[model samples]
Every structure is written in structure tokens, then in C-alpha cells.
Target: MLSYGVSKSSSRVPHIVTFCCNNPHHPTTTHAESHSVVTRRALSLLATATASVFSVPVLVSSSSVRYLEAAAAASTPRFSELPESGGVKALDLRVGDGDYPVNGDQVAIHYYGRLAAKQGWRFDSTYDHKDETGEPIPFIFILGSGKVIAGIETAVRSMKVGGIRRVIIPPSQGYQNMDQEPVPPNFFDRQRLFTTIFNPTRLANGEGSTLGIIIFDIELVSLKHL
Candidate 1:
């Protein structure tokens, strides 16, 4: 019976040792290893996803910037070109030619601004006129100070007092790169995307817009030479 008891104790001791070897600390170490591996993989995947998302907009913006640069280069010649008009006979007034001084000068005139394609008056001081049958509107401007647009300054200088002339101003000369108020968003965007920004007056409100021409029927009221 003593030998049998000793054998039983030896067998029990082996089992206890095996149980200690497989205890919580060993399992906890395995779990920690597994958790670390999973966390690393998840972080890698999140970084990849973030990079993929940001790359698309970056590519799009880059392409847009390139396209705009190319378009601006191509449209360079349009500015120096002469303007054409129908229905309203255009008067020959070349920019930077004749008495139209580029300096600051006070000028008074009757004028109207209209969209050439739409054939509608966009702005006119003619509304105050009690008589509407082919009458001129009254306006005053200080040239080069930006009381008016570049094209208007050019046109006003070409005309003598009481000379009725239809002057066509291309986008390059008029509001080049400047956004005029009351224009549609789509129109403004199209203009801005393609047009060169030019503010002869250097006003803060000047922004680029569509490639339309401005027709000015001008009568020079006065010129204050600077």
C-alpha cells in the first residue's frame, strides 16, 4: 500500500505541473500576440484607404489646373482682335488710338451696356429718359480711375462731343477677368475658368467673367486731363 500511494502521488504531481504550464499567463501572452498582429493589419488597411480617397481629388485638381493653363495660352490672341456687331452699326474705334488717353480723365456721356448675343440691355442710364425713341443715356466717368471699364475709356476718347458712335468692346478690353454683378453663376464660372483676369482700374470688386463684348454708344461730356 505504501508503494501504491507513492505511485499515485507521482502521477498527480505530473498533472499539476501540466496545469501550471497551461495557466492564464501563457494564454494571456498568446492573446496579446494575436491582438497586436490584428491591430497592425487594421492600421495598415486604414492608411491605405485614406491614401486612396485623397489621391482622387488630388488627381482631379491637377488635371483641372493643367487644362486651364493650356486654355489661357490658346486664348491669348482673342484680346487683340477687333469686335463685331449686328443690328446696331458699330463705329470704328481702335483701342489705344486717337484722343483716348489712358490716363485719369473725367468724361460725361450717354451710354448703354448690352449682351451682344442676347441683344438685351444689361445696364443703361437711359431708363430716366422720358423719350425712348433712339435716345442716348447720360453717364459720367473718371477714366483710368475705374469709374468705367477699359473699353469705355477707349471708346470715349475716340469720340468728340455729340458724336454718336457704336463702340464694340471685347472681353479682353472691357471686364477682362472681372466679374460683373447680376451675371449667372454658370456664366461666371465658365468665364472665370477660361478668361484672363484684367482689372485696369484695379478695383477689389473686379473678377473675371464671360467672353462677351460691350457696345458703348458714347457722347463725350467732358474730359479732365490728368
Candidate 2:
């Protein structure tokens, strides 16, 4: 028979081991083999625990990275270029629920006009009436009648009542070249819109040199047949 007793050693860190055997006739493990077995078991347990601890953090990090990528994709603003060569690039912010307006149909709208900028300052709005028209007074106009610029007219033609759109009007659809002679009665009364919606400040401040592209946030309020 063989057995081990608990005993204290001089070292502060103590390693304890206990073993017992009922029959001495059968061969038993040597101290080196016993220690080897214990060491292997401890190493296996440590490997399992380390893998378990580190695996959670790696999985969590991967999941967080995927979540952030999805969020960024969803939150990014969408801007589309027009398929046609000459048309304006219209971006629908909110699609309207009612029907679109036709040519000569009287349309009521509220709009905010601004120079396209990262921090675009509002040049004019129906909400504030920069040109002497009463604020919030809906601008009533006949569609497709040369009553407005080509970009605005094209945008409203596709909009339903209550829809909001942002249209980028190129110089061809906006103020003509300043160096060139004044155009004939073509696009509607630029003077009237100037007095109502557009702020002449850009021209006054000499910021309207080429007057390249203008941006309008327009909402269709109502439509009436002529």
C-alpha cells in the first residue's frame, strides 16, 4: 500500500499533491509521471479557459464592426446624376402622395433657394419672402408655361402634391451667361421670381459671376387646372 500525507514546506508558495493505492503488488506511477499528468491537465484547462475568454471579445469586435458598417451605409446621403444629358439632377427627399401636374396647370409651392455649399446659406424662401412677397404666401404659377426656370419646371412636373424635391439646375437651366447679351422672353419673368423668391444678393455681391448651378428645395402644395 502507498499513500501521501499533507505536509508544509519552507517555501511561501506550496504545491500540494495526494495519492493512495490499496495494493502494493501492482506497479504504480513514478513521481515524475504523476507530475507530468498533473501538468498536462493544468495546461489543457488553461488553454480551454484562455480560448473561452479571448473568443468572446473577438466575436464581439467583429459584430460591432459589421454593425457600424451597416449603419454608415444606411445613413449616407444619396445623390444621383441624371441619365439624360440635358436634364436636371432631381433627388427625391420625400415622394408625394397625390398626382403630378400637367402643362398649364396652376401649381402652388413653397421653396428655399440657396447656393449649393457644404454650409449652404439660404438665399431666399417662400417661408421668409426675400423679395417683398408675404412670407408663407404660396407662389402660384402655371407649369410648363415658361413661368419658371427649366430645372424647377422639370422637377415639379414629376412631383405629386406634398412631395419634396431637391433639384440641381445647371447654368443652361439657370441664369444665362453674364457676358452674353440678355435673353428674350424665354424662361418666365426672372424679375418677378427675383422680387419674390430669389435674393439678388448674389448678383449684388458679385458672387453671381457665372451663376453655374442653383439648388432648390421645393414642395408642391396644390394643383389646379387652368
Candidate 3:
């Protein structure tokens, strides 16, 4: 049997959209708004603390949002691959042999999430959390139903009951506009939701930034369907 029930390789992503308001300076609204034509990010946690929230805490360091823009006319691309087109990347860390899930299936999992950077910290983990009975709290969600991030849904569908995979969720697929960058017209509602859930203190402390990429380490615990 797979504890709860069921289930990377190194990958780097270049910085995408640059923002003006995501900085430390409380710049004049007039100046900031002028530059806000295209920039933004946020996390989409659940309604309550106990709810199966998907995601990580974040970090920020550069107080130079605008400065960096000035420093490099578009920072040099970090890696050779233009990963944006991939939408989400799921690198198999461990393959499992249990039943794989199909769409509409209810799934359970244990996950550890963090920023996609080398210095990123493990912000949230089911293994680290236990109920009064000392049992780890596994997250239950319906597969391919937008219950979690798009990347997570895609990754879980490919896994068996006991597999482990490292999933990469771009700002577009993860928290939409947590970084407050330019996204699609349709995603505005999701962006607003995450903005409300994101912790300002964490951002201020350089723990995570708005609209940043998310790195998730997922283990498939079990599946109820398919």
C-alpha cells in the first residue's frame, strides 16, 4: 500500500515579467501606475487553514524592481530552453506501480512546496504536519478539475499510487498574478483571489515574491477512481 495511500531533476527558469510596484519603495502612485501597464503574482490558498491549500511561502530580496529593469535591458536568459511554452514541467523522481488515475478521479497526496530558486525554502509540507493523532494530513482533490494548480493536476494524472514527482508550476499555471505580472484576460478572477490570500509579511521579508514560479515535490498517496 502506498502511507497516506499512494505517491526531480535540476531545472532553472529565467526571470520573466518585471514589475514596478513589487518593490520596497512606496513609490508615488502616479509614477507606479504609469509603469504598471504589464506586471503582477499571488498564491491561491484554500478558504480556511485546514483546507487543502496548494502552494508555498515565498521570498524577495531585490528592492530594485525598477532598478533591475534599468540595470539590464531584459536580463539575460538563464537557461537555453524557453520553458514558458511548456506551461508546466513534471520531472519524475520516482516511478510507482499502483493504479494511475484518470480525469474526474479523487486523489490523495503528500507534497512539499517551495520557490523554484536554488535558495528556496520548503515552505509547506504534509509530512511536517500531523493531526492530533499524529497522522500526516494528506490532501484530497479531484483530478484534472482545477482543484489544484494545472501543473499538479497534470502531474498527478501521470503518477501511480506510490510515485514521487517534482512538478514545476509557472506563474501562469500556479498563482496567476501573485507577482502581479501580465497574464490572460480570463485569469483575472484567480489573480484577485491569490492577492487576498498571499501573506504580505512573507513578501516583505524576501521569503517569496508575487507571480513567481512554484516548485512542488509531490507523492501520490492514493486514488479513488480509475
Q: Best by TM-score, which number?
A: 2
Pitting candidate 1 against candidate 3, the one with the higher TM-score is 3
Predicted model with the maximum lDDT: 2
- Residue 103 Cα positional deviation in candidate 2, in Å, after optimal superposition: 0.9
TM-scores of all candidate predictions against the true structure:
0.37, 0.54, 0.48
Per TM-score, what order, best first? 2, 3, 1
Model 1 per-residue lDDT tens digits across residues 95-123: 22235434666666655456553454344
At residue 169, give the lDDT of candidate 1. 68
Ranking by lDDT: 2, 3, 1
- Residue-by-residue lDDT tens digits, candidate 3, 74-121: 322222222443467776666888999999888998887665543554
Error of 2 at 220 (Å): 0.2
Candidate 2 achieves a global lDDT of: 0.58
RMSD of each: 29.7, 23.9, 17.8
* TM-score quality measure for candidate 2: 0.54
Q: With candidate 3 superimposed using the best TM-score fit, by how many Å does residue 137's alpha carbon deviate from the native?
A: 1.2
lDDT of 2 by residue, 54-73 (tens): 21112123344354344435
Predicted structure 1: lDDT: 0.43
